[model samples]
Target: MSELLNNSHRRKEVLMKLLMRLHEGESPDTLRTELAETLKGIPYAEVLQVEQEMISLGMPAEEVTQLCDAHSSVLSGLVDVGDAKAAPAGHPVDVFQQENKAILMTISQVRQELNTAIQSSGEDFKKSVIALRTHFNHLSDVDKHYKRKEFLVFPVLERQGLTAPPEVMWGKHDLIREQIKGIHEILLNPELTAEELQPVVDLVIEPALYALAEMVTKEEEILFPMCMDSFSENDWAQVHEHTLEYGFCIVDPVGNWKPTHTAETTAAKVESEVQSGHFQLPSGRLSAAEVQAIFNSVPFDMTFVDNEDKVKYFTQGTERIFSRNRAILGRNVLHCHPPASSNIVERILEDFRSGREERAAFWINMRGKMIHIEYFALRDEEQNYLGCLEVSQNVTRYRELEGEQRILSYGEKKSD
Candidate 1:
């Protein structure tokens, strides 16, 4: 029994079995007590790996999401909070830390407004209600922040074989999302009296507000540190680049950050001369160098996925709407989106596969730019299904065009 408990392989087997039971609807309290004794002295990172491995082995995401609340309950007091370190300005971690400050401040203001409005009536209460309403609305922007982590950051972490932690956090993200939506829905009923608003403050708004604030603590202490320790410099650079598409929560990033490689490493990989090559395409043929230059020079960004549902390629643009890095190659496209939108993605893939749909289009107003996104299903000459191509473009400048001009004016021409 001593040797069995001491064995790392045995420990993982036990952990998986416990989690499987938990998924099978075993009592969380019972498992928490039973497993706590067995799991003592196990590194938190190892525990996270256990869960990630379970998910990858075919456990349902929904089931894992449900099990986490209970699973976390067991680890709550026993496990130590993760390391917390200061992130430098302009780094991806720095951006998240900054946003947490803004989010916490908003929650504080909402609390004050709720306190003042609960006892007051008439215009005073109405004014306070309006303030609370706006606070929660602004709080809704947190979804964009969560989406960045869920879509861009998590996939990279999973690629490195750290899957469980991201899955658990993604679950919490879903819970918080539902809470925010509930609070938003409660406020949509404008006819409610001051008395009506009080319950919302107590039941809906406060719980959600507190949850949001606590997640900041979780991100600072648990998520960010683990990511910092595990991810490489280039990995962070990839995350920073992708954040542009999702936009920030309420915080604005000050500038670009370029992670520097070590001098020794750079020296090791340096070559004497550049190797050149050519490529052929249906439209025309271009040298290998020209292919990349053309893709970057174009006003749009693009990503392609093969029929196996794997990400094959993405173009780098002067201003990327979303971040793309070589690390994402061969990753399952399903894992590339937030849980909220993954359903839509699956439906799109299913439709294309079934020959019910050939192409789909969507557009959104992001930070004053009209960003257009389109997906086309690829098929061969014999009509054999191949893959899906995603094309995204910022049409803000194009939308402002008026009148035809035969003359070519290139450099920022202005009409007065």
Candidate 2:
């Protein structure tokens, strides 16, 4: 080891090589000792500064985030991102921080309920469940937080050419969501006994609550700070305006700070840069909201995977055969499935991309309902492969309609 600290140029060169090694498939665990020796005594701001430099040089933020996450094993000792500055009243970060506090409180309550259940028996067991249900339901607020980040904030970052980090975070959001959903399912099970539910409560529920805690820390330490540095005042203003539409997590939005420049100041410069209103296609014109409504009104659930195999959107039909939420949006198609099922998802995308397959269909019986799932390859007029679309429908009622009647349907009568 050198007797003196390296100069700025030397330090940055070392940081880049370290990131490159991790990018080349070096396991974080294997590099832990070396990382500790190299960066352990260094301030956390170094990590942040190097990552910002990478973004400045056109490296994707997500790639930097991935390397950061992989090396997070040593972040506890080496990185002191320092105390997060307090966000003012009505500031976007303020609202998120408030929600994070609420989320943590609920998670604590859930732990208490679990301890009570562990200490109780028979009638006492049922009594503990009473408290458990409330805590579990409170955690549902996380969905709103995630939705705002994905739909409202991510697009702005994408416009700024930072897509990967948001995608990685969305994947984490989905994982958290699935765990929360599992906890909910346990709450709903009629025959669920304390003994049977104990393992799930411990493994699924506790891990999820802790994951949420870690996410809040990551947001405060890394994500939010990065956004503060990267997003423009107008971008923050627009995001702040749209955030209310998705609603809040555990806290309300507060703050009266306005940007120095409003839409008028940025209009002409960002007109086309801004994405709003209707899409003018050759077939027809419909605003995004109208298109969403039409998609929901349709009889089946639909999902669009983009050219890079990222999940771009999914329609929230009334009776969707599969479950979906904003967390899955912009997530990689491969991560959306379980490990065992990922092979099929990858094979399908390969076939679609290679122009070897146009469509794939399958049917199954789920919870006494018939499910018909299909995937189709999407292409441009020149046959350039675009992506894949997945549509799934519940066909139980359709299967039972064996005979047709000449009588007008009830819907037809209303039209007449």
Candidate 3:
């Protein structure tokens, strides 16, 4: 039995057969039992290989995506991770796992509150709904978690020809995102009663939470371990560097991680580029130092998304209303926003790309400050769309200005 399990060809064949059975509508419970009895444990890599092979053999990626959860459930405790590498403290994978732990804890709390709401009535149920809403809001933070994986980790995997898994996982991510959005919409009704909320809890809420938890399991047991085995130290270092842009989920990484081997850091590379030469614009030429200083000196935060929808540049203003980091440099602009907001972003991008809109503006009160944000469609001489530019500024002082001073006020003091 051990020798047969050791044979990679045979193991993958058996795994593929079981997964195909699941695709054919076999019961997950029956498959789980069969996997346990027949395979005992399958290497995590074989699981990915089998999926890739299936796709290569003419199975539509959508079909594989549809079967993702079912197969993951069937192989829940059956993936062999005995040889998985341990991530160093503060490594990207380590941080991802830590965030998963925090997400799981939040899920547990939500379940407890759900149980309370299930047995209660009237105000008590309303209170439970409020609690559930707060928990679900926290769960929405999982968007950042998924974005980091989608923008940073998945690209690296794709470059290695490990494309199918990311596609399947991204489809699952979208499904989970839609589920969370649906739950939010249902929870926002002011007239919702306990009777109305019960069906939603059973249908929408539980399923969303289950999907969220299941993805975490897939990441830790299969994805992360496989990445650790496949990626070089430098690959991890780059991932760690870019992680700050999407931000952490529930917990921040404890410390910094870098490869032991000497290599040029991102900061050092940037410095080298800055010192190399000048950037000649269509109107004027400026040294890299001058350009950097000008961007940083700008009062408003500015970000430019290229025609391809990738984040290409952002100003580094000292008092930015929104955070910016190099990690977001190549990320899709849509992925930079939460799932709830991505729809709005997509709409704006479409309008800009189609020349239907030139600009969009919005304002909100944040931490007692009124912030103004606007997006502009960039065009060339021929009116061809180049990209989108986002500008944000704190307009609290401007809004509160009583009157304009006739004279210079740089060193003037006002009397109360």
Candidate 4:
């Protein structure tokens, strides 16, 4: 172990020797055991340094992933040594770990099933191939999962002056994402026969599975440990609250975390103590007080655009399925969308302004809620051009309505 640690060169050289020993038909358990012991009791970043080195040395991504996972398992028991606290229920760390575990298990199962498909009979063969592709679609959730970590968790770590691991991990994440997307597309449109899937199995699917597995290890070992070391309890609490907005990859947490002191009430009390001016709605005849009430009372979100197509303002609805803060006010409407989507937004605005289209619609399902969105051109009393009105509402219940009745049937069950 001392000889293993004392080497001045990167650990990748040692790992290559160890991996070569395995390939050379030598017993690998001794070296693996030795490596694990050296990794134990070290700072998780040190372990990650070894991981990066191993990857650079032509060690299979899977082996490195396994090494990281093994390192984490060892550290899981010793985590109490640090000032780190258990991720309170629904904490980002807790949610990430739970979701990641399920994804890893699913990836493991898919890999095994595909392996069986390669060696199996006729009926089992097609079934395994289809299962592999179907699971590939499910793998998209893994990308979404990691994105949250990159955006949310990485920023917090960066603030603490630790930046290297997240960036490296994000790069590996992109590679894994591309591999999954490629495999999924191949499965969806088969340019390759089942026999040809063999290389994909080796090159794309296998490496991806290993990459995800390694990430899980790095998260549990390096990322989470470092986070726990760096973040305050309040930071975890804030993350836990935000988790509700983005949600988890696989795990559905049974409960939520609530701050001991209510930020909601404190905020409300502060707001009540402050002075706020009433707002004006697009309806020209309405009073400011009435406009405020009308906007707040409606069951939908509302936004206004001037005749020139600049986004003038948007209302803040508490039940908004998608967040829209005042920061977006007066910003170019195109800037609200992702770069890839800006052109489409501009086209819509053009059509609306030219009278080629007076309205456009779009909707999405989020967290089991179906949200309906619509944009309409608002004309004046003279029927001359004015602006566009954007309205969005949660229509989950609205879409379920059947035959309409005039009377208030109120609380009673309706017969089909």
Task: Using TM-score, rank the candidates from best to worst.
Answer: 3, 4, 1, 2
**Global lDDT of model 4:** 0.65
TM-score list, all predictions: 0.53, 0.53, 0.67, 0.54
Off by over 4 Å in 1: 1-44, 53-59, 67-74, 77-86, 163-168, 253-256, 262-416
Q: List the residue pairs that clash in candidate 4.
A: none
Between prediction 2 and prediction 4, the one with superior lDDT is 2
lDDT of 2 at 364: 94
Predicted model with the maximum lDDT: 3
Worst 10 residues of 2 by lDDT: 407-416
Q: lDDT by residue for model 1 over 7-49, one digit each (tens)?
A: 8777777778887888788887887777778866444455677
Candidate 2, residues 1-416, lDDT tens digits: the string is 35344555566566666766777888766666676677555443455556556667777656654454564553445554555355567677777877888888887888888888877878787777756765665576687789888987789867876655666678778888888878766865656677887788667877777678777866766677667667777777777766655656644445565445564355444444444567899999877777778999999999999898877778877877777755455556665665346569889999999998999998999999999999999999999988899999899887877556455664554321
Q: CA shift at 376, candidate 3, in angstroms? A: 19
For each candidate, C-alpha RMSD in Å? 10.9, 12.3, 6.4, 10.4
Is candidate 3 or 4 superior in lDDT? 3
- What value does the lDDT take at residue 150 in candidate 2? 90
Give the per-residue lDDT digits (tens) of candidate 3, residues 106-225. Answer: 999999998988788888987887788767766766877898899999999999998998999998998888998788778768688877877987888888888888899899889999
Which 10-residue span in candidate 3 carries the lowest summed lDDT? 259-268
